[model samples]
Target: MSPQLLSLVTLWAAAALYAIAMVAWSIRLSRVADERIQARQGAGAASSTTAEAAAPAKERVAVGGGDDAAVAAMASGATSFVVDDGDETDLPRRSGADRALGAARAAMYSGLLLHLVGLIARGLDSGHVPWSNMYEYTITGSFVAVAVFGIVQARRDWTFLGAGVTGFATIALGIGLTVLYAESTGLRPALQSFWLVIHVAIAIISTGVFIVAAVATTLQLLQYERTDGERELTGGAIRRLGIRVRNGLARWTQRATWFEAIPSAQKLEAVAFRLNAVGFVLWTFTVMAGAVWAEHAWGRYWGWDPKEVWSFVIWVLYAAYLHARTTQGWLGRRSAWLSIAAFVALIMNFTVVNLFFQGLHTYA
Candidate 1:
């Protein structure tokens, strides 16, 4: 078979592995949730029994004098408790969950290796960089996203993110293969310079990082919403209906119990913030490199092209998100929503602007 065919086959295989990883991660999460729920129920029962046995001692203390002592006794006897959602070390590990998590890690590593192989084959077949067009860009971007996730997972058990990352990579590869597939062709005149390598490659990496950051931010938002009390719906019928639907979905997700295993909203927010910071730095370089490349190729530094405009918009959105988070103390749901919006703009810049809008950057 040709190198191109080999590349395509390997990419498909990688996507299949990613799908398996997603399923395995999901299974692990389900098992963890079940264990947590059972543990909580047992704790609740034990607490109730202890409180019942202590009721007469508490009454004796109350009647015997020392009002402050009575208050302390009552406080100690209170049954309400808060689970330490951020730490899983205290929880009993289940063999099934461990096996599922192990399977997920194995699948992710295998998929990443296959993905690397596919990219190498694509580069060989194209006789140049592998990300010169939409299809190649999607595949390369997804690979970078998964690679970054893997690197982070190595240092920390970020298996909670595995399902999201792998599921996204699989879907993205599917979309690239089906909707954006293109024949291997020589680069356009404008894309022949080394600047193409620097600018587009950085752009792809930054985009991938942004994708992972978006996923983290999204989870943070969900976790924050779950922990925070429900908002009151006050509006017309249609608006109220929408709110009801949203609240219903939130309630359903709350029942999953897996949220207890993942890190708290604060931790997830920190991870997202750090990822976005790195992505923003890379994206800053990408925009600058693009302008430099454009000056060399088109004899101008900044044209009001659709691509340039959208890229600048994305940069501004992320810049605002970071600035607000750091200086204005928009730390929780607010920052998460802003980060999510910025990612949405980035997606639009990649897909809508590339396909529908006409500009100098229309080479794709």
Candidate 2:
């Protein structure tokens, strides 16, 4: 096979591996949640029996200072309990969760290697930067997303994000291979400049960062709402669809304990804010570089092009998100919603603006 075909094969292989990783992570979360539910149920049952049968022996049990009194006290909500952290051999279920997490991490690492190899092969075959069109952009963007996730994982135990990051990469690769796939071809005249590499690369990187932040923001919003035990997922059809998508991984999202495993909503919001801050800075430079490139190619620094307009809209939305968050002291929910809106705008610029709107940035 040609290098291009081999690249395609590897890219698809990577996507499959990512999908497997996503499934594994989902199972990990699900198993953890299931075990927690069972434990809680068992504790509740034991406590109820203790509370019901404590009349005659209550004084004696309390005087004896035994496990029965402790159970009765905990059942009655009269005592505080601290869970013991013991050897892993004591909990077979926890050991299973660890194994699932290990498998997910291994699969993600393998997929990342294949993804990088595919991108390198595509670049070698095209004799230029591989991200000249939508197909190439999706592949490169997803690669960056996985790479960022890997780096974060290496530094910390970000296993909570494993399913989300890998799922995004898999979906993006599938879409690229289907709707956005194109033949390996040379760059168009307007893209025949070194600026294409610099400007677009930064933009792709920023977009990848934004994608990660978006996932965090989304989870934060969900967890924030779920903090109230009475809170339910309610909305119109589209909102229901989003909830359904999240609920598909029944293990990861079905239980409140799963959310508890991650950082608190405030901490998640802080992380998302930091990520968006970096993306915003890079995107600002992306706009400036685009203007410079436009001046060189189109003989003007500014035009009312559709892509430019939407790009500016994204910047403005994110800018407002930051301003409202920092200056106005917007709460977590509001800030997270603004972040989602900004990402939605970014998605529109890439999809709707490229396909429907007529503009100089029709290369997609």
Per-model TM-score, in order, reads 0.85, 0.79
Total backbone collisions, model 2: 1
Supply the TM-score for candidate 1.
0.85
What is the C-alpha lDDT profile of model 1 across 1-364, one tens digit per residue? 8899999999999999999999999899888888888889978887778857565543423333345544555556644333333444455545888999899999999999999999999999999999999999999999999999999988987778888999999999999999999989998988899997899999999998898888888788778667754557989999999778768767856876777777888899998999999999999999999899889989998999999999999999999999999999988878898999999999998899999999887876
Q: Rate the local accuracy (lDDT) of all candidates.
A: 0.87, 0.84
- Encode model 2's per-residue lDDT on 1-364: one tens digit a residue: 8879889999999999999999998888766776677778978887788856555434423323355645666656554543333322333344667888889989999999999999999999998998999999999999998898789778876677778989999999999998999888988999999999988999999999898888889878767656633324699988888666555544344354656456678878987898899899999999999899999999999998999899899999999999999999997788899999999999998999999998899986
Error of 1 at 78 (Å): 27
Worst 10 residues of 1 by lDDT: 80-89
Clashing residue pairs in candidate 1 (N, C-alpha, C atoms within 3 angstroms): none
RMSD of each: 9.4, 7.3
Superposed model 2: Cα runs more than 4 Å off: 34-94, 229-257
